[model samples]
Target: MMRITDHPVLGPLENKEVTIQFNGVDYIGLENESIAATLLANGIRTLRYSEKERKPRGIYCGIGHCYECRVTVNGERSVRACITPVKDQMIVESQGFQS
Candidate 1:
């Protein structure tokens, strides 16, 4: 539903469907697309909870400068989703700030 059908400069993006598990929900996204882009495209706004207040946090900087989009990939902690590429059958867990 969130996939871009047409672009002004890039034109229609090719659809190569790939599945990624987020918070135990299976969602479809483009292959090789950044995890942050994929999550945003799928209407996933909150990627993690704040360390102290436990407030919801999502992609603040798309270039990995901000650590808001941190998620656990394949049991690896603190993986930045903004720069990480999506892989088939990847397990993504919404993580909170590590104390």
Candidate 2:
């Protein structure tokens, strides 16, 4: 997966690195950052899928306003990844067929 190792404007971000499990795969992300940000940093764009049309959905409005960025977190359903911070060992999964 593609990752943002360095940013031109922000340069290299210095934050506490933590491991989070996504779909049973381990990925390292920054602690206290939003789950969506972590996922985007790790090249994860599709967060969930629509129940009706089964369309892929991702971050939109990114501030807890839109529900498109919903994902399952630690067995909890409909969790907003855009606003939820990444925690160490947190299990996150895309809401694939769950409605």
What overall lDDT goes with each candidate model? 0.81, 0.82
How many residue pairs clash in each candidate at the backbone level?
0, 0
Off by over 4 Å in 2: 1-14
lDDT assessment of candidate 1: 0.81
lDDT of 1 by residue, 50-96 (tens): 88899898989777788888999999989998878788899999987
> For model 2, how does the per-residue alpha-carbon lDDT over 26-69 read when each residue is reduced to its tens digit?
98888777788898988888888898888889999877888999
Runs of candidate 1 with Cα error greater than 4 angstroms are: 1-14, 97-99
lDDT of 2: 0.82
Task: Tally clashes: model 2.
Answer: 0
Q: Whose lDDT is greatest here?
A: 2
